[model samples]
Target: MSPISILTFVASLLFADLVNADRVLGAYIFQRHGDRSAKAWPPTKLTSLGYSQEYRTGSFFHDRYISDNSSYQIDGISTDIVNLAQVTASAPQDDVIDNSGEGFLQGLYPPVGSIATETLRNGSTIQSPLNGYQLIPMSDVRSGSGSEDNTWLQSASSCSKAKFSSNNYFNSKSYHDLLSTTRGLYQSLEPLVNQTFSPSELSYKNAYTIWDLLHVALIHNSTASFPSSVTLTDTVMQELFVLGNEHEFNLAYNISDPIRAVAGMNLAGEVLTALNETITSGGKSKLNIQFGAYASFLSYFGLSGLSSANANFTGIPGYASSMAWELVTNDEGTGMPPHVGH
Candidate 1:
């Protein structure tokens, strides 16, 4: 394996070795939504490529975890029954996440042969409808709905305490220390950002939106050139992208205070709750929970754990990238708690 991939594998093993599970039993997946238009702009919708990307991700999961010959497959549960009672799917209420979940589930339990043949009381064989496509229940968890917490999926925006903690990081010596090398890059980009958004709307404290605009424009609209004369060369834009990503990282999880990871803590708690429910209920009530959020949150989640294992764990996750924390056990039902791995 490449160095980075090897590091990630070693990290997973370390996490899995803790508490010593007999084998993997269940899992929880937190994924960054697939390709979409810039959120800073309007009509932020998923692209056709986004749908295809997530579909492939789901298919990959099927081969690894749900296939009949896979070690992770639930005993006595056929792949055809995955959509019936063996799997439950979900995402955030945002349309981007919702669509991504839909595409992913379709791949996990594709339409070709989703239904099972059954004999009725009158001895008549009944074939399922919808062209053998089973409809899996997908619950979009709305923030602030009853007891649902916003920190779970919207941690970058919703965690009040984490926000407070992150603010302190900006004032820390480490931030200033890094700024010495980055200040020049920011200076060049500041004028462009100011021109794009009102002074009140954008600032050094939160210029991620500006960086995002530049990024999207470079990727999606570069052939036509930018509407404004705020020219940014490819090298400059790439540097700014890295800096902006770092800003987002520190905002989500600062090293000085563990409270900076409060958002991740909240989401991790929810993941564990879902996994434990799946295990405690003998997989009867377990959910195939799928969380969709931005790459910033995914980096933060990793910084809270994986960074300790791999210092180079700093790249912003790719579009539709996912992390799964599998719950493994053995014949004796002895296992460790779920840990972030594949």
Candidate 2:
């Protein structure tokens, strides 16, 4: 897993760098959106809990990358009012992802209050709204804008080769076998979605969709009774989770066809490019963050050989899960002679 690097479970990576490098120059972060209403059902939104989760996750990173207490803090980065040029952020136009990005940034650059006040020529001091709230701008990578393709966050419809590979999974023998074996399992859960999805959608083909709806409802609508009287046992939920994981993982990566993980490949390139900026700018550009989904995580894990290093890496990432690439070196001053780390 050594071609390039970004950190998910960061302890190992950070520890390795601490042993090899003296100063952290910069970093590139790619994080999943916070919990939301299930994507399996549309009109999805970022829940309040989702917002909190993202904020906490961002604050955690702030402690790790920008706070004075952090030993690995990115050199030359701001801890108060943001130097916007030193950092860059982006997310898709999607509501869930975009809002999650805002929440995370709020944590990363918290209200500086009087610390950010500016004195006018008349000697009157003014503070930004919400107690010197940092107005950090994030680029909205609009869908179908062609930017997504380059950034490795593109929708399925945009990548013909990847799309073709994903569709091929549906026609495979393994798919057919699973559909047959899971017939009764899926049929039993029909009562839960019969009112919303038509009868045709109650089959194994919609395993992930059906499971997603139920899973999200359990988390967000726990006070309410389920639509059906059947016992929604934990065993059944786990089974459903496994099935959905299998389905989505297949869609994201297939070792035989590199095209399947195009998004992940592009993500590696994007991360490399971001880190390169820090090197070229002599550490002036210190941090870069992007909000995204787990499909890209799965794709990247498989493509970058992380799955081989740790089997758990193949699984879909959870809400707010982040991977980072730190640009670090032993050199002093502002000269950023970057060193790569796994």
Candidate 3:
């Protein structure tokens, strides 16, 4: 080959290598919440024991990340995405266990006549403590009663309309039918959920769990006295504990193409920006960003509702504000070039 040609070839090779170097401009992450007890409802709320379970779940995340290891760290200039908005139309109402009606109460006490006999049988009681205990006789307890006639009127009233309708609104069949419809809706969206991430992805199991947690937290922040800083701290803590393990480390290491990695990061940043915008906007809906389910971008970010919301958002089409960069050949290498024309 001629000297000039040889020189040109070497120069092109070097340029290609330079172009291939990864430059991460942004990133977007959508994650599901960590594991949680079933949704608060007749069937799902934590039993008296469930309260402990909830605390333990919270403690696990807290200790794993917040106290034990400060693991969530990233390189380069980028943006973080989080949804601070309240997306749930309603809060989780009193669980059904708390509202089993008069029958539940009746079961706790002995039969109306039996209670008096038991109180007398115990004997040692100085005077059977009746001040706090308001037990109605079994005969007096209302039977064949509708919901309103139930013993725990106050408890029943605390339940939300959604819960009441599902449980007490109609008989068990009506409740089951409503439940079926809800399940059907969820099943229809199953494809989108499955597509959001791959099984091999880091924290895949925790992704959906985290999403649900965030949803719960968002609701708490909206209706209760939860501090935003506490919620944010909880979020960061979970990310560090859950996503900063060896699995993700290896996955990050496996990417041989620097430009693709950088592109992925940039895409992640865009998502973060959108999420931040959604939170700051004070709207009821969450920011939904959908990449193919296999992408795992949301899991990477440690937020959840984005993908779920993406699947359901009626106003915006899929992947709003998404920027596509072209894999182009430059003097450097296979690099993503900023596309000028759409």
Number of the top TM-score candidate: 2
lDDT of 2 by residue, 131-194 (tens): 8888789896432222222212334336788878877888989889999998888888777767
Worst 10-residue lDDT window for candidate 1 reads 1-10
Instruction: List, residue by residue over 185-212, the lDDT tens digit for candidate 1.
Output: 6666656555556645444444456666
Worst 10 residues of 2 by lDDT: 143-152
Q: What TM-scores do the predictions have?
A: 0.73, 0.88, 0.18
lDDT of each residue in 97-198, candidate 3, tens digit only: 222212222222213332332344556533324423323221211111121122222122222432333223224353345334434333332332344333
**Ranked candidates (lDDT, high to low):** 2, 1, 3
Error of 1 at 229 (Å): 8.6
The superposed Cα distance between candidate 3 and the true structure at residue 48, in angstroms, equals 3.4
Off by over 4 Å in 1: 1-23, 69-71, 113-130, 142-158, 173-195, 198-204, 227-234, 285-287, 295-303, 330-342
Q: Considering TM-score, where higher is better, how would the candidates rank from best to worst?
A: 2, 1, 3
Model 3 residue runs over 4 Å out of place are 1-45, 73-91, 94-274, 277-342
Task: Give me the runs in candidate 2 sitting further than 4 Å from their true place.
Answer: 1-18, 142-157, 332-342
